[model samples]
Target chain A: MIHLYQNNGYNIVLDVNSGSVHVVDKAAYDVIGALEEQNEFHTPDTLKSPETAAYLKERLGQEYAEEDLTDILEAAAELAGQGRLFTRDVYGDFIDEVKQRKTVVKALCLHIAHDCNLACKYCFAEEGEYHGRRALMSYEVGKKALDFLIANSGKRRNLEVDFFGGEPLMNWQVVKDLVAYGREQEKLHGKHFRFTLTTNGVLLNDEVQEFVNKEMDNVVLSLDGRKEVNDRMRPFRSGKGSYELIVPKFQKLAESRNQQKYYIRGTFTRNNLDFSNDVLHFAELGFKQISIEPVVGEDTDPYAIRREDLPRIFEEYDKLAKIMVDREKSGRGFTFFHFMIDLEGGPCVAKRLSGCGSGTEYLAVTPWGDLYPCHQFVGQEEFLMGNVEEGLTRPDIGDAFRGCSVYSKEGCKKCFARFYCSGGCMANSYKFHHSINDTYEVSCEMERKRVECAIMIKAALADA
Target chain B: MKHIKTLNTQTLNNTVKKGGCGECQTSCQSACKTSCTVGNQTCENRK
Candidate 1:
C-alpha cells in the first residue's frame, strides 16, 4: 500500500509494505495517486499495459506533457517492478512464521511498588493500587522475577527489567536489591541485564540519582507540563502541586545523566490541548528527551480526548514538527518520543508484525509476583498469566496476545502507519472493544498523525 | 515538473540527523506501554 500526503512543503509517498519512501513533485504525486485510483494492487502486466498508458495520458492530459507523464509512469512502473512501490502484501507469508516462532521472554516491566505516594488524576494505575491493595514487591519476589527472566529468556542475552510503580522510590531498597542480584546472576546465566526505573519524582533525591546513574540503563521521570497543568491532575495526597517539588529533581537527573538517556514523559489532556507548548516548555527546562502522551479516558471523564479535539491536536502536531526542525537547526533540539521514527533499517518484520512482543517476549510482573501482558494490564485479573514462581500457568492468555498484529487489528489492517505503530496499544484495544485484535479510533488517528509528522520532520531536516 | 527522489532500504533517510546506538533495553515495551517508537533510549548508548 502507498500513502501520499503533503507536509512541511514536501510531497511524500510511502510504500508501506516495502518500507520505501519517495519525495515526489506535484505531478509525479498525482500520477501515483491516479494509478492507485485505478488499481489498488499493481501487477506487472497491469503496469506495462498500453491500455494503462493511454488511460494515464487520457486522465491527466492537460496537467503535463504527455512525454513527462509517460516518463513518470515508466519510472513508477519500474519501481513497482523492483518491489519498491505499489508492492503486494508479501508479509502474509511470514504471519505463520511469527506465530510459530519459539519466542522467549526478553524484558519484564516489573511493578516494584503497586502503591503510590501522590495521586494523579489521569493515572491508569489508579494511583498504583491497580484495583488491588497497596503493596511493594518483596526482594524475594523481585529476585525470582529476575531469575524467571534469565530462565525463560532462552538464547536471548540482553534482558531488561523496568522498575515501574506508583513510585519505585516507595520501595527503593528492593529495587536496589534486585539490581544487585540481577548483576550477580548475569554472568552465571550468560545474560546481560538492563535495568530501568519510572517514577513521579516526589521521592527523588541525591542518593537515588547517584544509584540510578550507576545502575540504571534508562529512567522515566513523569511530569505533566507546566505548574498549573501538572498540579491540577497530579497533586500530592494533601492536595499540593508536584510541579515545584519535582522540576528541580527532574532537571538535576537529566543533567547528571546523559540527557538523551532519560525521558521526561508527560500526559496531555483536554486541559492541555495545546501540548506543543508543553513540549517546548520541557525544552525550556533543559530536557533533551521528552514524551507527552495523550490522556485517553472514558468519555465521561472531563479530560478524555474526544474526536473533536483531533483537528486542533493535528494542527498542534504540525506546529510542533516545524518547531522541532527550527530547534534542531539552532542546535538546541530535543527528542520527542512520538515523533521519532526510523524510515531505514527499522525493526525486523517480526517486530513490525507483532509489536513490543507483549504477553509473549515482554511481560509485566506485579508487586505480588503475578504476571500480566503489560503494565497497562496490571490490575486486569483476566490477563493473569501466572507468577515468577510457577511461570506462565495461563499460557493461553499470552498466546492470545501473540496472535495480535497489524493484520489482525481491524483498524490497523489498512493503516499506512501499521508497521510504525504496531497495532496501537493492546490495553487500549481491550478497554475499548474487550478484545486485543480490535483497536480504538482516537489512538489510531493520533498514531497516523505522529507518523506523518515524523516523516515530515525527517524530510524538512533533510532539506534544511 | 518532475521532482522525485526514491529511497529504498539501503538509501533510507534517517529521521534523527545524529546517528548512534539505536538499541535500548525495554524501550520497545515502554513506548505504547508495549513498544518503543524509534527503539530504546537506554543510557548504555551513552557509555
Candidate 2:
C-alpha cells in the first residue's frame, strides 16, 4: 500500500508496507496520483499493461508528452520492482503470532507518587491522585514491581523503569532507594536497568539535580511554555504560577545534562492555538530538546482540543515546519518532540508498531502495586491487570489490549501514519470512547498533520 | 523539494525487538494522547 500527499512544497510518497519514501517532481507525483485515483496501481507488470498504459495516457497526456509519461511510468514501475511502491502487506499471517507471544514486560511506568504538588487545571491525573487516594509507592512495593519486571521480562537484558507520578519528586526517598536496589540486582540477575524520571519540577533542587544528572538515564521536566500560557493551565494550589519557580530549575537541569537525554515537555490547548510560538519560545530559552503535546480533556472542559481547532492547529504545525526549515539552514536547529519522526531507521522499519506497549508488555503500576494497562488507565478499575505481588491475573484484559493494532482498528486500516504512530495510545481510545478499538478523532487528526510536518522537516533538512 | 529525477529511497529494515513500544521509545508517552514521537530508541543515555 502507498500513501501520497503534498506538503510544504514537497510531493512525498510513502509506501506503507515496505516503508519506502519517494520525493517526486510534479510529473511523477501526478502520475502516481492518477494511478491511485484509477485504483490500477498494484503490480509493476499491470502498470505496463495495455489498458493501464492507455488510462495513464488519457489522464496525463495533455500535461506531459507521451514519451515523458512513459518514462515516468517506467520510473514508478522501477520503484515498484524494488518493493518501494504498491507493496502488499505481508504482515497479516504473523499478526496473530506477534500478539500471541509471551508477555515480556520490558518497561514499567512506576507511579511512585499518586499525588501532585501543583493543581494544573487540565491535569489528566486530576493533580496526580489518579482518582484514588494520594499516596507514594513504598520501597517494598517498588522493589516488588522491579522484580516483577525482571521475572516477566523473558530473555530481555535491558529493562526500563520510569519513575512517574503526581510528581515523582513527592516520593523522592523511595525513588532513590528503588534505584539503589535496582542497581544491586543488575549485577546478580545479569540484567541492566535503565531508569527514567518525569516530574513537574516542583520539588527539583540542587541535590535532586546533582543525583539525577549522576544516575538517571533520562529525565522529563514538565513546563508548559511562556509564563502566561504555562501559568494559565499549570498553577499551584495557592493559585500562583509555577512557571517562575520551575523555569530556572529546568534550565539548570537541561544545561547540566548538556541537553542530550532530557526533554522539556509542554502541553498546548485551545487557549494556545498558536502553539508554535510555545515551541519557538522553548528554543529561544536555549532548550535543544523539547516536546509540546496537545492537552487531552473533556469536550465540556474549557481547554479541550475541539474539532474546530484543527485548521488553526494544522496551520501552526505548518508554520513550525517552515520556521524549522529556516532555523536549520541557519544552523539553529532544535528537536521538537512531535516532529522527531524517523522516516528511515525507526520502528516503521520493524514492520510492526505495537504503539505504547501498554497492556501486553509495558504496564503501569500504581503506588499501591495495582497494575493498569498504562498510566492513563490507572483509575479505571475495569482495566486492572493485577499487581506486582502475583503478576497479571487479568490475562483476558491483556489479550484485549494485545489484539489492538492498526490492522484491527477500522479507523487505522487506511491511515498513512499507522506504522509510524503504531496504533495511538490505547488509553486514549478507551477514555474518549468506551472501546479500545476506537480512536479519539481530534487526536487522530492532529497526529496525522504532525506526521506530515515531520516528514516535511526531514526532506527540508536533507536538502540543507 | 522536488528532485531532478523521481528520487526514491528504500528505508532500512532494522529487525527491532517487540518488547519496547513498537513505536520509538519516547518516555513522554506516559500521558501522551496526541503527539507520538516515532523514534525514541536511540537515546544518548539508554542502555
Candidate 3:
C-alpha cells in the first residue's frame, strides 16, 4: 500500500514499502494519483516545520554554525518531512550542493582497434574517414591509461573500463592483455572493476563469446531488429547482407549459458523507424535487455522517423515491457539496464555528498592518453581536459568540470527534468551546440516524454 | 566580499550559458519555453 498528499501545492506520492516519495506539481499529483490508486488513498504523517528542522540539523551534523544551520535545517526539514522527495528533498539537495560537482565517467573507451569488417550505417566512428589513422593501441599506451584510471579510482569504489573502435575485437590481443592487467590491478587495489564493449557481431565467435562471458562483464551487440531491418543498415564491408551471420552470433550470445549475461542494442534510422514488432523478434532471440537509439550523424535527415512517430516508440517500449513483465510473472527473471529506474524505482542519478560532479568523479581518457569530459568526445579538441603525461591531478580537470557552465543552463536549472536528464547529453552539447554549456532541447523533451510514458506504464502495471 | 560576489556572478553566468538550450528549430516539446521557478533570479536566489 502507498499514500498520497500535498504540501505547498505540490503533490507527493509515497511508496509505503520503501518510504520513497516522488514530488510533483499539484496537477500532476492529482492526475497520476487518481488514475493509479484503484483502492482508497491514505494520507500519512505530515511532519511539522519544527520537527523537520530538528531532523535536518541532525542529518547535517553538529560541526556547523548554529545560526546558519538553523535556517538551512528548517528549509530542508520542511521538504523531506513532506513526501515531495523529487521537488523538496531532491531539489533541496541539488540547490545545497550548488558549488559541488560529481564525476559520471570513471574510465574511458580507448579505441584500441578502429578496423572493422562490417559497415554499420549508424557507426559513430566514420568508417572510411579515420581508416588509415586507426592504429591499434599498444600495450604501453594501454598500461598508462590503466594506471591513470587505477590511481584516480583508488580514491573511489568502482572504476569502469569500456573498449571502442570501428570494432574493438579487431585488436583482441590488446583487449586480452589489458583485461589481464586490469584483473591484477583490481586484486592489488581492492576496487570494483567492470568492463563493457559494444561490437558488431561479425567477430564474436564461440571462443570470443566465452571470453566476453568470462572476462568482460557486459557486451552490447549491435542488432537492429529483424533480418531485413538489420541487413539494410548493418552490412559487410563489401556491402553484402550480414544479417544471417549476425543473427546466429546474437543467438549464440544471448542464449549463452542463460539470457542473463548479454544485452542487445538497436539503432533506429529512417529506414526502419516504425519497426515496433521487431521488439517481439528481439524477445524471441533471447535478449533480456535492449537499448533503442536514433541514428545521429552529420547531414543525416532528422525526421527519418516522423515527429509523430514518438508514440510508436512508446508503444513498442510498453509492449516490450509487458512481455518482460509476463515473463517475470511466470517465474522467469530478466533485468534491463535501459529500464534501470523502472526496475529500481529509485532516483535517476544518484546524488553525491557534494554537488553535480561532471568532470571530477568521472573523467574520460582517450586512446592517445588525452583526458576529456567523457567517452563521447574522445577525439574532439574543445572538450579536452588534459594530456596523460602530467596527470589530471595537477591540471584543471576538476576545476573545469566543477565550474563548467554545463550544469547551470537557464533551461536546465529551471526544468523539472534537471535531476533526471541533466541538461541532455554533454556530447550532443559539444557536437551540435558547439559549447559544453548548451542544453540539448530535442533530446531533453524526448527523454521527458519517455520518462512520462515509463511512469504511466509502471503505474498501470503496478495496479494490474 | 567584492571579489567573491564577482566570482559568484561569473559562476552564475557560466552556469546559465552551459545550460542554455541548444539553438534548435525543431518544434520539440523540450524547448523548455515554459517558465520555471528560478529564472534569471540571479545567484542570490540560487544560493
- Candidate 2 docking: what grade? acceptable
**For residues B1-38, what per-residue lDDT tens digits would candidate 3 score against the true structure?**
10000001121112322331211111111111111111
| Each candidate structure's count of clashing pairs | 2, 0, 13
Candidate 1 lDDT tens digits, A112-200: 99889899998888988989999989999999999899999887788888999878999999999889999999989888888889999
lDDT of 1 by residue, B1-47 (tens): 24668744532122222322223344454533533353222223334
Give one digit per residue, the lDDT tens place, for model 3 in A1-464: 33455422334454322224344443334433432332223222322245443643554435445455444333323433343222222333353244453333355556667567888776656662242365667777887887777776535545667676667888788888988899988888876667777787888888888888897766777778888888888888798988788888888787884776456777777676565556556866666666565555554465344455666665665565566566666755354333433223222222311222345544555556667655555565655677556676434556644554324566565444454444555456655677656665655555554444344334434434
Model 1, A82: alpha-carbon shift in Å? 2.6
Rank ordering of all candidates by TM-score, starting from the highest: 2, 1, 3
Question: Best by lDDT, which number?
Answer: 1
| Tens digits of per-residue lDDT for model 2, A205-314 | 99999989988888888998999999998999999999999999999999999988888999999999999999999999999998898988888999898999999999
iRMSD for each candidate structure, in the order shown: 6.0, 4.5, 17.2
Q: Top model by DockQ, which number?
A: 2
> What TM-score do all the candidates reach, one by one?
0.94, 0.94, 0.69
Error of 3 at A268 (Å): 1.1
Clashing pairs in 2: none
Answer with 2 or 3, whichever has the higher DockQ: 2
